[model samples]
Target: MRILFIGDIVGRSGRTALSSRLPGLITEWKLDLVVVNGENAAGGFGITEAIYNEFIDAGADAVTLGNHSWDQREALVFIERAPRLIRPLNYPAGTPGRGAAMIEAKNGARALVINAMARIFMDPLDDPFAAIDRELAACPLGEGADAIVVDFHGEATSEKQAMGCFCDGRASLVVGTHTHVPTADHRILPARTAFISDVGMTGDFDSVIGMNKDEPLNRFLRKIATSRFEPASGPATLCGLAVETDAKGLAGKVAPVRLGGGLEEARPGFWP
Candidate 1:
């Protein structure tokens, strides 16, 4: 299975880049499944129904969310209707949308996509480890799911790394999001799961974590916020992690993808 997991879409810039590039990449890379983190697709807040639909139209098999999953009030309602949209699995019992989903890839293979939020330096949600364990147990990788992708959205690197290790041999890929910066540690773990601390944001790198430079810089220097933080207007770099899984649903190859905008282009050399 050739799977691609895109990082967070910050705002319009990020969305534009995705809309323009994803389809071509899908064909060029012969991707079987594509998952995008779209929590910040709407003005760096949360994704809307339209934006979510846009992502699906642009070849996204599944769209994942983070702590900002509920930032857009409409999400609470629309999420129930969008089966391909997944929120954090560790949310309280009554959370609106599902934390994981089993969707068929373009190649007709079944893939289990799970989105879970970490507790470190963030909301005190349910234990992510236990939550994911139950999900994976219910659907063993090779038997029930041909491919399993875990999107661990969090602030701390340690927590994300731990999640990757926890799901090491079970999942096809375990990539982190939320910090908005790509980490260089993209590699297949000992157990065969593709792991990366963070895949970075698919937005302009000219700003502070995808936001306008002024507001964040002002807030930091003056310790006061006089203006609202907005997404940068420049071109965006579509950042993500690509993995090729074996018949047993374990990653055989993993690589980072950074394209367009200010970042240098990176694509797996093994792919034709």
Candidate 2:
């Protein structure tokens, strides 16, 4: 099974990049499953119903979310109807929408896509580790689903790495998001699951974490809010991780994906 996990999409720039490239990548890479983080797909805040549907139409099998999952306000209502849109698993029990989704892959296989959020320096939600364990137990990699992908959204790299190690043998891939900067450490774990501390944001990298530079600079320098933080409208570089799993739903090959804008271009060399 070939899986591609795109990092957070930060606004028009990120959405534009996904729309322009994802369809072709599905055909070109022969991807069986695609999951993208869309917490910041709105005006640099939360995702909207339209953006969620756009991701689905663009061939994303499942769209994941993080702390900003409720920024748009409308997402709270629309997400209940969007089966493929998953929010953090460790959210309060009554939180709207689901944490995990069973998506039928393009190849007719089932992929269990889970979105989990860490607690370190983040919302004091339920235990993400225990939540992930429960999901993985209910749907064992090779038995319940052909593939298992976990998007651990967090602010701490250590916590992300811990989640990756915690789900090492149970999931097909464990990738991080929310940091908005691709890390150098992306490799298959000892148990065969692919792991990366941060998959980066699929938005313009020229600014401060996908936001326009001036405002952040102002706040940093003046220590006061002069204006709202807006999404950078420059050309974006789509960032993500590519993993090819084995027969037992364990990752066999992994690579980083970055294209356009500021970052150096990259694609899975194992694929065409």
Clash totals, every prediction = 0, 0
Query: Can you list the residue pairs that collide in candidate 2?
Result: none
User: What TM-scores do the predictions have?
Assistant: 0.99, 0.99
The CA-based lDDT of model 1 is what?
0.96
Off by over 4 Å in 2: none
TM-score of predicted model 1?
Answer: 0.99
- lDDT per model vs. reference: 0.96, 0.95
lDDT of 1 by residue, 1-272 (tens): 99999999999999999999999999999999999999999999999999999999999999999999999999999999999999999999998999999999999999999999999999999999999999999999999999999999999999999999999999999999999999999989999999999999999999999999999999999999998889998999999999999999999988899999999999888799
RMSD of each: 0.6, 0.6
Task: Point to the candidate with the largest lDDT.
Answer: 1
Candidate 2 local Cα displacement, residue 44, angstroms: 0.7
Query: Can you give the lDDT of residue 214 in candidate 2?
Result: 92
Model 1 alpha-carbon drift over 4 Å, by segment: none
Find the 10 residues in a row with the least total lDDT in model 2. Answer: 88-97
Q: For model 2, how does the per-residue alpha-carbon lDDT over 165-256 read when each residue is reduced to its tens digit? A: 99999999999999999999999999999999999999999899999999999999999999999999999999999999989999999999
